[model samples]
Target: MFCTLLWGSAAPFIKWGYDLFSISQTGDILVFAGVRFLLAGLLVILAGSLLQGKLLTAGKAVMTPVLTLAFFQTFGQYFLYYLGVSQASGVDSAVITGTGAFISLLMAVYVFRYEKMTANKALGCLTGFAGILVMNASALTQAGGSLMGEGLILTSQVFSAISAAFIKKFTRTHDAVLLSGWQFACGGLALMLSGLAMGGSMPGASAAGWAVVLYLAFVSAAAYTLWGLLLKEYPLSRVGIFNCIIPVAGVFWSAALLHETGQAFAPSTLAAMALVAIGVWLVNRPETPDKRSENQTCGS
Candidate 1:
């Protein structure tokens, strides 16, 4: 829940950062994101090492997973997301990206075979998605979602889901925080290079702009490190369902911080929150003994 809230603040903060830094071009956005993640990676490594009482070095054993995550999680996901958001409506982007948890569930159950596809998981995902729809009901009625825009956003979600599954798998053998930090470092570098290659440059930087970058970096560092630990110990569904809370938190922070409070406390927003909370509960609810027994039998 805390991690999701941190992530939710990101959209509004990124917008603010762009304005403060005078960022308008796609290349500049990529460079900004790259810098944030690079700083975040360093913070995680430094803090995680201090906490663990040793240096968090990436050995050859961990390099494969680190690079894999760097590609899917950091560089690929954010690259597509920035591009997609530029072309898509904010409502469309939110609604589409909200499917990330649902995608993670499906991939975990089928592709990874890490868990069974239970009725509870399926229903919970659907319910959460419906809440997202209701929450964005006003803007959704405006009919502006294009193929390129929505398509790229959905693709970015796929990368995110894949990264989650791989994190769960990798953490079984490697240190979760170590993997996260190094992967972030690698991916951030990649994004920086890509942005620079595309003629991106940050011409102006203020103390406030730098502060925003630092805060955003901390958000990613802390949230992802803790989230990696959670995935290490729990089923993907158990942790992933909380993703629905992100958009809700984003709306709240956007309202309070960005002063887009028109519908912050509206009935629709409150109702949507209720639906999302219920969906999270349903997903994390313990399975009945009978259901577990049936699953075991089916496995045989």
Candidate 2:
């Protein structure tokens, strides 16, 4: 819940960051994102080291996992997401982003075989997805999004799903904090270089812009580290299902911070929130003894 809320708050803050930094170009967006994640990584490493009374280390054995996560989680996901959001309608982006939980669940169930694909899980995802659509139904009625926009957003969710699986796998052996820090650092560096190569610049950013960066960095560091630990100890379905609340949180925060309060109080918004809550409950609800026994019998 805390992690999802932090992540959700990022939507409005990011918008503020772009406006404050006067960033509109793709390369500039990448550069800004790179700086944010780079700082986030350093913050995590410093704080984590202090907590454990030693520097967090990522040896050669963990380097592969770190790099793999960097590519899919940070670089691939955000790289495409920023570009996609710029091209897509806000409604379209919101709907596509909602698919993340579903995609992550699919990867956990099928790609990694980390969990069984149960009926409740499928229904939960469908219900949560419906909530997202309901919240955006007003704008969704208009049809005008490009393939580059919608397609890239969908692809970014796929990358996000892949990263979730890898995080669960790697955290079994490596320090979750170490993995989170190094992967963000490596991914940020890649984005920085790519942005530079593409002629991105942030020469005129003010103090306020930098402060927003700091906040954004903290959001990523704290949320990702905590979320990694959760994944370390719990099933992917259990942790991933909570992500359904992110969009709902986004709406509330956007209302509070951005003064988009009208929609936040609308009937559709309330209905959407209720649906999301129900979906989350369904997904995280404990399995019945009958179902467990049935599964055991089937396996036998």
Q: Assess each prediction's global lDDT (C-alpha) against the native.
A: 0.82, 0.81
Q: Give TM-scores for every candidate, taking all chains together and pairing residue i with residue i.
A: 0.88, 0.89
Candidate 1: C-alpha lDDT = 0.82
Positional deviation of residue 14's Cα in model 1 after best superposition, in angstroms: 1.0
lDDT string for model 1 (17-132, tens) is 77788887877888988999999999999998999999999998899999999999999998888777666544345545667888898898889887787888788878877876
Candidate 1 residue runs with Cα over 4 Å from true position: 85-97, 135-151, 263-272, 293-300
Indicate the worst ten consecutive residues by lDDT in candidate 2: 87-96
Clash list (residue pairs), candidate 1: none
